[model samples]
Target: MGGATSIKVEVYGYSFDNTDLVARQLQSGMLKDPAFTQVTLSRDEYTPEFQMNFDRTKLALNGLTSTTAATAFSAAMSGSVASYYREDGDEYKIRVRYAPEFRTSVEDLENILVTNAAGQQIRMKDLGEVVETLVPPTIERKDRERLITVTGIVAQGAALSDAVAAANKVISETQMPTGISTVIAGDYEDQQDMFSDLLVLIVLMIIL
Candidate 1:
């Protein structure tokens, strides 16, 4: 079977200061190859997500904890299933969720009300803050190693070997920083492994 072009670049840093930069550069370089008809990024550069961090002291003062905070969040944003409604032998789930207006903005989250042990209503902002972050929607990891892959499809009539050559060119030419590494995987890596095994088998057969 023919192999698809795949380039794996693993960038490591305390902060992801260079991860996106390197990924964009690699993708741009691979696309310049004439053999590559198209180049696409698996993860977008800017994917937005919210991270809420709670103050332990404030939480304890309000008789709340991380677990309860999570529950409150889930109930607010994702909704909660209160009960099932059955009518004329038909059943439907009843989920109570916040309206779009009430859950769409940072102000809304800050204004969320969580009850205290004293049965007093407390705003979520009094306990924690929401941090906006641009993170990858999905991150693929193998064997606990974080990886970003640059994949290219070979142009029509281009041989699979051409793709492998392009991959090698990028691997050798790219100047990698400290703690970052590269490895070729997918069909190309598997083909190399198979060829090595075939060579051993032929050598043993001749000896026998």
Candidate 2:
């Protein structure tokens, strides 16, 4: 029982404009980068369901049914919320999705169920397009342009300043599309502001 005890590494903080680009650069082992023991990239993106609103009337005129379209969508990704199943004295979700083999393509998604008010079945493709795309995660309008931010955490024993510097270099050098720009804002700025305020108070007291 005389083995060395465990060691813990603490990271102070980090700053980054593009978390994904940093991840790729780190993965390529470009800068004696620490092997990220654990990485979690957290960012929100707009899903197809939220971006498009189906026009039921338009579908009906085109011999398409809303029920069929919705059903097809549900069938492909998630089936109607099925009842819960109990196992081992605990309850668990029982989502019924199209078997993986059947739901891989846009064709499969388009072919999903479209039941009519008259109890008729139709194909989703007959009415509208079922396109999956990435819209603005959260539209931020600064001078009338959209923006997205990516953020993540680094493991212990990692130098926060080194990471931030590396991230800034990557951001400045990386090529961005015509309308996109990146910015870094997190705990680092907060700490800097707090310290600056504290310094001002200390200097004022000394002068008095």
Candidate 3:
């Protein structure tokens, strides 16, 4: 009923893997069916990211907390307000951070200094690891829940009702995990709403 494609299926869940798994299953089933073609999942590609996984035990032993370590890492990567300069009754912020050349590579990130509560300077590498990972390039949400879409093209001879029935069959055969749900949206949903409204009008006319 929303601004969805003519043949679109939406899956909603909190876990990325679970959502992807369900989407893939539906896409595969659609491809196998003769009614649908050009089936694809929305999240076909991922973006590379550098993720810092911290060790809480190590941090605790060094009299440091996760917050302290995270603050240091953020300051090094993103400049922080070091001081304020005032001139001519106007104030300016003096931000200090590592130079581009000093923070280009993972090695450089590991070398950034972190001072613990005990006044000990520790290497960032000792407390955590920087791993390269892939994440969804774009995240979509509906009603505050994460959503993924599966789109397909209807075959020339196939009716929209047939395509919807195929999709429903796949959904029925699949076991959805907890906290996950699916909806058949797009043109079919719109058609259903139109039919319901027409039925109501016909009933009112008969009563009158």
Candidate 4:
């Protein structure tokens, strides 16, 4: 059997920090409300990432630009097209990338070589350092703004409107920080739009 539509409230903010904060608050509020159940946030888990921080002074001294260092790192870890190969009238890209084993650890990344304008090869570690950090698995955006979706299941005896109203009450009671906003979305928003259109049609018919 197919599943029913879910209730999703989208929280938009200029920055991820604010957006995540508001989303968590909304999720907490929904969970406490009797009208909602199974309240959850659509935020993805953060993953470990290694970021390369280039030392500008070292690059300038070594006769290298930031772009040169970044490109070299990217080529080693990700890949870059070296040339093209044509076989049977089909042209294929010849890309070059480090083997998985060679680029697995921070030490491996630091050992990658970078070429400078003077045709001299320098060790990446000498130019920059790799720092460990955490980043989101995926970033979701709407209308060019960062978005975090809060979702919930309405209780058995509660109507969709009741759930929405309860959510709105929670939102109104919470002190929203600057640059953060919320909108009730999903089936409920669509239903409201449909009803508004129907009302407009009915008014037009009565006028005629």
Candidate 5:
């Protein structure tokens, strides 16, 4: 089991791409710093997502909506469970989806078919295009601004305050993108909140 974490660091930015870069850099710097044993990115940076872009005018002409086209495209790529089969004492799901040849590339989406209001088959190509791009698997927002978290694990016998102070130094020395900001969160934030509450309780006890 992992030891109780002593602190957490959150590096914020205007966009995920910029924040991710900084988080990685911060993690590398933290490992090299004497104050921390390891600093790891809270989220993976290079998650690939398929984007299907459609022309609204074209869709309207074909009596199709973006929702309709997206639904059709998702069904084709991920497949739909249509039925089931029973074998021996186990039950199996039988699914229907596009063949590998049709689901292999972005161009394969062009072959997708969706029926319009007219009951006519409309090819995806007629609606728009598709592209593969990097997208964040999970989005984190603080004050409605995007941020990335880089968690720093203090070395055994090292003080948590030293790790936090070292991280703050790194943030100060590191150049950031315009409009980007950073804030400490995770375990560190929780620790601060708990201390504040405890201080209040102590002061109340003395007053009583």
Candidate 6:
């Protein structure tokens, strides 16, 4: 991470496989760096139906339906602009939604209303389920494999190269799980390129 007056070096590892094992190895390397401040490991998983079932059940129990429940929930989260009112040459939208406190919990969500064909108000819980959960973080796929990242933060005045080298050594000594490989990228690649160019320039100067 960098600030207004100086640049700080951070080393990050990108991996497609055996993320858990690599994370542990990276964690160990951070412990050895006096300049190390923290390390983070992250992975992504997908589950579309996890909490959806609860929403469906809640709607069913409340004498409402899924379509109605969905509409109510959406409106509750994002207010709808019914019309625009002009005042002093300026126009403002007339937005409608439940009060913030009213829609703060699962119970509040279940109580949301959806209008039916018969003009009856249906509760969200009547047609769907509502359960609190950690929705899996989004993932981008490359070659049909999940990606994981291990990030390390180095203390001020620490050389990025030293931190990266230490991280690489630790990773190499650790036994990686099958189907996993770690790669150094981002700023590390730029540093490598710069170093290579400098060495070539020095050699050329001597030859001349």
Q: Could you say which candidate leads in TM-score?
A: 4
C-alpha RMSD of candidate 3: 4.5
lDDT of 5 by residue, 101-150 (tens): 88777778788999988899998889988888877667776678677778
Candidate 2: tens digits of C-alpha lDDT, residues 1-208? 1321111111111222343344344333323444233333333544454212366766877565566566557655766657798989999777777887667677776666666667776666666666766553543333443333333343356555655665566556655534345555454455567889999999999999
Model 1 has an lDDT value of 0.73
Model 4 vs. true fold: TM: 0.81
Local accuracy of candidate 4 as per-residue lDDT tens digits, 151-200 = 88888778898889888988998788898889899879889899999999
Please name the candidate that would achieve the greatest lDDT relative to the true structure: 4
Tens-place lDDT digits, model 1, residues 1-208: 1654443434433224455566667678878888777766556566766667899999998888878886887688878999999999999999998898997778888888888677888788889897777775566566776666666777778776787778678767777666666665665666788999999999999999
Q: Which lDDT tens digits does candidate 3 get at residues 59-145?
A: 888888888888888888888999999999999999989998977778888888889877999888888897777887578888888
Clashing pairs in model 2? 68-114, 68-115
Residue range with the least summed lDDT across 10 consecutive positions in model 2: 4-13
The better-scoring model by TM-score among 3 and 5 is: 3
Clashing residue pair totals per candidate (backbone < 3 A):
0, 2, 0, 0, 0, 17
Q: TM-score order of candidates, best first?
A: 4, 1, 3, 5, 6, 2
What TM-score does model 1 achieve against the real structure?
A: 0.72
- TM values, all candidates: 0.72, 0.47, 0.71, 0.81, 0.69, 0.60
Backbone clash tally (model 5): 0
**C-alpha RMSD for every candidate:** 4.1, 8.8, 4.5, 2.9, 4.6, 6.0
User: Local error of candidate 6 at 198, Å?
Assistant: 3.2
Output the lDDT of residue 127, model 1. 90
**Clash pairs of candidate 1?**
none
| Cα lDDT, model 3, residue 130 | 72
